[model samples]
Target: MPLLDPALWSGKASIGTWTPPTGGTAPVVEPATGDVLDVIGVATAEDVQVAAGRAARAQPAWARLPYTERAAVLRRAGDLFTEHAEEIRQWLIREAGSIPGKASFETVTAAQECYEAAALVSRPLGEVLPSAEPRLSLARRVPAGVVGVIAPFNVPLVLGIRSVAPALALGNAVLLKPDLRTAVSGGVAVMRVFEEAGLPEDVLHLLPGGAATGAALVSAPQVRVISFTGSTAAGRKVGAAAAEHLKRAHLELGGNSALIVLPDADLERAASTAAWGSFFHQGQVCMTTGRHLVHASIADEYVERLAHKAAQLPVGNPDKEEVALGPVIDAGQRDKIHALVTASVDGGARLAAGGTYRDLFYRPTVLTGVTDASPAYAEEVFGPVAPVRTFTDLDEAVALASATPYGLSLGILTADVMRGLELAERIPTGLVHINDQTVNDEAVAPFGGVAGSGTGARFGGAANIEAFTETRWITARSAQAPYPF
Candidate 1:
């Protein structure tokens, strides 16, 4: 079955179906071949207001619904992801510029998140505290009423659903604003899954739109919490707007994450890890290894291995061929990635492997002899480009990794795992993996960035609680206590 029915935008709907979006239309294009996949509704600022209104009305009832029933619905949602994994995978590949494996990963992530969110309903929601007076005192978590979720195009299914499912499960309504470019996989598909799983009417609204729509959602008086995942620049605006409105904004922003290779690390294994970290999903990831810090002893061999791996990996239309990487999202994104690489080369960073493109298919690139000033090395080059920079010693490695303002994910490869752990602590990062590469996540792990990255611990496990709910203190007594008159 098509995960998102085009009829959803028909300006009309039968009972128990999606409310027609209040926006214009845009064509969904496959980046690989420039094929118009489908025409989808584009939400406006007014559309966001409408969605927020509906969500506000629906939220109280959803919050009051029996927790078991809510959990059941979420479990069913999880099942749907698994049952329709193939169709979802196809949409992800075609619509989101994901390769088959990456598509599968997103589908699995969606399912896993649902299962984890369902479990949230069964967790203890309140705690008893000491009563100073003749009364019982308790602190309880209550849903933040209507949640506003603005998700990005890259890894849309997971990034959107991670917050969406948990907020709903925690007893809140959601107005989701996904980037119009990847609306089908990011917004409509996830909404469709919830609908099939029997989510209550008006509890979730999916609106695909541009920045103005997001601004509306952020400023809406009814939305109590905003979950935004995108660039650092946009995240700052979201955070500022949310603060002005006195609501919570959970932002997971950009990163130029690093992978450190120690001298003792096996060159072959470390290079393989580095290649996957940088090139996976065309390196359009928040935790993409933008800087490669390798000990000078093995730097030359590591560069050769990394470049060879990048060259050998097949890059093409994922749906048509078994390719390791797919096309970049569009010409603009492709050009931007290429510009960074070219600028780095111009600034004296040697191009070790790729610095070319065919249509939107930018080759996986590697750079050697890069300095901190290299644009591609310093910036979050969200493409299939890996820039290798050499560090002379442990102190130098620490300096190189700490050079950026971002503290998202950090990876260190070393034969001495304990030493790697010590090094990880010295460098500030929200997530770190010793003997591994930077890009990694699981549904159960707390995932967020810090410093220039974003608000820390905004999703997964206990972080979800903080993101989706508010703590309210309650006091009760068998008889009403009188205050002094």
Candidate 2:
């Protein structure tokens, strides 16, 4: 069949095994135009149970395959993603509200992630260790059986694949639960790639539904690990539920990240960076620069320049116009973003640029004169809103940045790279950029956050060794000699 032909998926539930859904069906609506794209089944708790059982049964043989054979499958999957990039790009634009550039980027990144995961298979998996007794000892890495991946709507393709590809590459079966709004791009597309790449039947299950499905996946007895990417509030619940089952949950959660511009930095360059960091993908990113901390001496010029950049960028339906930003996921998200802006303005922050939206198309907004009391300044807006604050010195900048419980990503721009590095040490964030924006990702870099942002279960390169695998100690003796008895 053609890639993601609407008729092919209509009334079907999963990308694996072609089983009918037990939780009924949901219409796939395009948020930008309010058009029903297709109809897909919504999986229920019972479906999760069945998927878990299938995964448990299928995992052993898959794991027993030769490492080279497994790696070859992943390599083929990567190539398939590139070969079908245009088709995947279209789905991302229509289903996830991604701009053309963003859609293209996702396809490239998805292929890169799969390639990286392919390489992971041949990496040194175990190490020899010293033993006191006359025996050979070793420490080995093994897959956590039946991994459960729960991904979000924003950046669906990258977020889902980052976990799914690596977990499967490590010889674990996966049960993925993607948010309903962008299920086709996030869940179904992934299933198709692995399926065509020749993954064994029942090794991966795609469950698309609401909270009930996610909860079922998290708490399933057969699910040994959970990989979740979403809000902090929901992440906390996932963590708790997984703990109740004594399983680990890898969480890459929310953030109200900051971008600090020192007085010595280039104003024009800094302004451009700030605008991209806060407004790219409509600021619906975990590492979005929610707070802009500029030195007081250069704050006015920076705000003015940043506001101009935000205003110059166009916003509309990506399918129709050439725009820098497209509509958010839905109406509820738009309302929440506007309400935060209104609260920030009511609390004394000045609207430096945009503060209005049409339907789901929220304008890129900038704010000045913000304080700790401003809601948008203090909260994770998850919209195209940038709230700026002025700091007199490095001490005040550090103080302001550290005030939030979130410690995800921090960016600092300055002429003196050494001083920027020095300042970064004082902050508690997981990732830092000396002279770049906060919204950055690579298939090779270890990406995640700290504190409320997540459990610090990073995904990428060598980090995957720890995220998806468990360490075991094994010993071999020449013979079974004498016992105490």
Candidate 3:
């Protein structure tokens, strides 16, 4: 597939060409091959302010349209995704280091998000409240004007559209700041989709830049709600800035999620799930199983099987048909993961299989004897590495899993499905999977995390629409009643 032209985004940002106040242009590097894919102009604070102002002006007219009319445009955009899936897949592989399978999944899921968000037009926003007197009282949901979406590099396209589609569906204009690494496909490509789908210009603005641009968006008075997905450290700044400015901020942050295996669980299936969960997309996913807590009775055999599975999976160029794991985002990320793995092994975490990298391609690594204090066991490695531990008691396993500051997602594998469900409830994370891995998501499900993972503001279903809207209470009287005012 040929690389997309950078001219695709030229003059497409808020109202006109988005000239950066400084910092010129940045190269988008292909991590797998270290290729200079293209260059994108960086947006500045001045550009962010201009985009937010345009979005604010465009939003009220959009909100006044019947939801069905708005849904039509979004539904067309959804259809366009399926029609252009292959091209999007190619871009994802080149720009984001997504294997073919992962790229396909993201593109299809993103399309599904657009389709589902269209249905949100019919979803009830507010309920009628019963009154003691003969007055009628009810609440109506209204758009929060302009929504600011700051998405991360990993899974940039889907995560960007996840907020953008729903915000537009709920009658709000959007100011989107996609990750600098994925500006071309994730940000500019999406803008084209909406534009060709007949969405009015200025309703959706794409500003691609770094932290300064994001900070400007968060602090913009015209931007009423801010929805962000990225690292916890970045999210903290975005959240605090939005709060200081009194903007509604909804964040989907980092995670160090876990997958637990009970003694009676299917070892073969559990091993397969573990390998896939820990290494898919080079484990860049927020819900990737960073830690594995297995029953002591079966830990040895399970780890052995998992190691075998990890070793056999192909790890190479994301463009290949058979490669299961791809490169991390960049050399810095690869070095970070490598350093963490090296430190963990030095700290007594047994390297059961694969602890090496060739350029950006890191092997699928599995470790045992990882103690609670090990960095591999504690932090979000965000790489294709799995660190397993043994636990005799379920309560102990739950406590150990919840020890991290993140509460994003959890997975439990057990023969007893009912017991897994019970344990799922006891888990502190916002999402839990029974007899499955931690890295699972659907377009229609309520997706988010709790605690350090996120703000508990889910991104799908009716909650998606609610996140971009505000509720207003209104009352009507059949007849004027004497009041002491």
Candidate 4:
């Protein structure tokens, strides 16, 4: 298949594409082959203003439409996405370097999000509260007007759609700024679906560019809400910019999540889940489990199991179905991962498996005997590296798990139900998985982090809808009593 032409995709819409700022066009490269996929047009401050103006004009009409009618449009979009899943999957593989399986899963996840949002919108926002007097009181959940969505490159389809679907379903207009790396693939695929479903051109806009474009969207006065998913440092900057305008912002930032393996846990299962979570997407996920805290009684055995499993993951072209692992997003990320591993090794951590970077592909790495002071344990190693530490008991394990500044997601592998529940309550993260790894993300569950991990929530059905909306209280009394105020 030929690479998608941005001009052609934008031409399909009535509103048309925003032209690049002077001398601002940049190449979008495929990580695997180092090939230039396309030259994406960058947006300027004026471009953001124009997009926001168009959204403001279209939002009221969209909000006025009945929930069922709005849902129908989204449902049609889901169908369109399913029809073109393969093409989108290939694009994701080339641009984002997502393995074939992961790419396909992302597309499916995006489609499922659209269908789920449609179903959620059909239900009433709130129920009436009974009152002693002959009056009515109810809560109405309403949109927050124009929203700015700044999505990350990793898991672009899933993360971006998860935010955009709910915002649109709740009757808000969205101006999306996808990461410059995978903009053509993820951005164009989503815009095509929404446009084909008869979404008003003004209601949805795709502004593809680099940091300047993102800053423009966050700093725009007309943007009422900003939803961002990226590093903690970048999230802080975006948060500060949004605060200047006093716009509501939702951030899903960095995570150095830990996976705890208890004494009674199944070693095989823990090993497999740990390998999958740490290596999947080359550890680019914010919620990827980078730290493993295992009970000392079984720590050595579990580390050996993880090493064996890590060696089995095939590192090759993302387009190959059998390739379990692929390259990191780019060479810069590869270098970062490499440096972290080198520092860990120098700090007395034992390298149990892979630790070398071949171009964009970093070998699946496994480390043991790491300390809390080591960077690998303290920071978010966003690569295919797993650092393991030993704990004598549950209390020690919990302490190690909570040591990091991030509290996004964590996992505990234990057969005992009571122990699992106890740990789940004590853990500070937003989501906890029992008998699994940190990579487990469900569309129906509330998936956001606590502390530096993030603020606000995504998924968990109605909670997501609530995140994209504001609540208003409506109270009614007899008309004769209206003068009392």
Among these predicted structures, which one has the highest lDDT? 2
Better of 1 and 4 by TM-score: 1
Tens-digit lDDT string for candidate 3 (292-396): 999999999999999999889888887765688888999899999999999999999999998999999999999999997889889999999899998989899
Task: Put down candidate 2 lDDT per residue, 406-448, tens digits, no spaces.
Answer: 9899999999999999999999898999899999889999988
Ranking according to lDDT, highest score first:
2, 1, 3, 4
Candidate 2 regions exceeding 4 Å error are none
The per-residue C-alpha lDDT of model 3 at residue 272 equals 95
**Tens digit of per-residue lDDT, candidate 4, span 25-106:** 5677888879887776566666777888888899999999988888998898888778888888988998899998898899
- Output the better candidate (2/3) by TM-score: 2
TM-score of each: 0.97, 0.99, 0.96, 0.94
Ranking by TM-score: 2, 1, 3, 4
- C-alpha local distance difference test of each model: 0.89, 0.91, 0.87, 0.83
Tell me the deviation in Å of residue 212 in model 1: 0.4
Worst 10 residues of 1 by lDDT: 9-18
Clash totals for all candidate models: 0, 0, 0, 1
Shift in Å, residue 410, candidate 2: 0.7
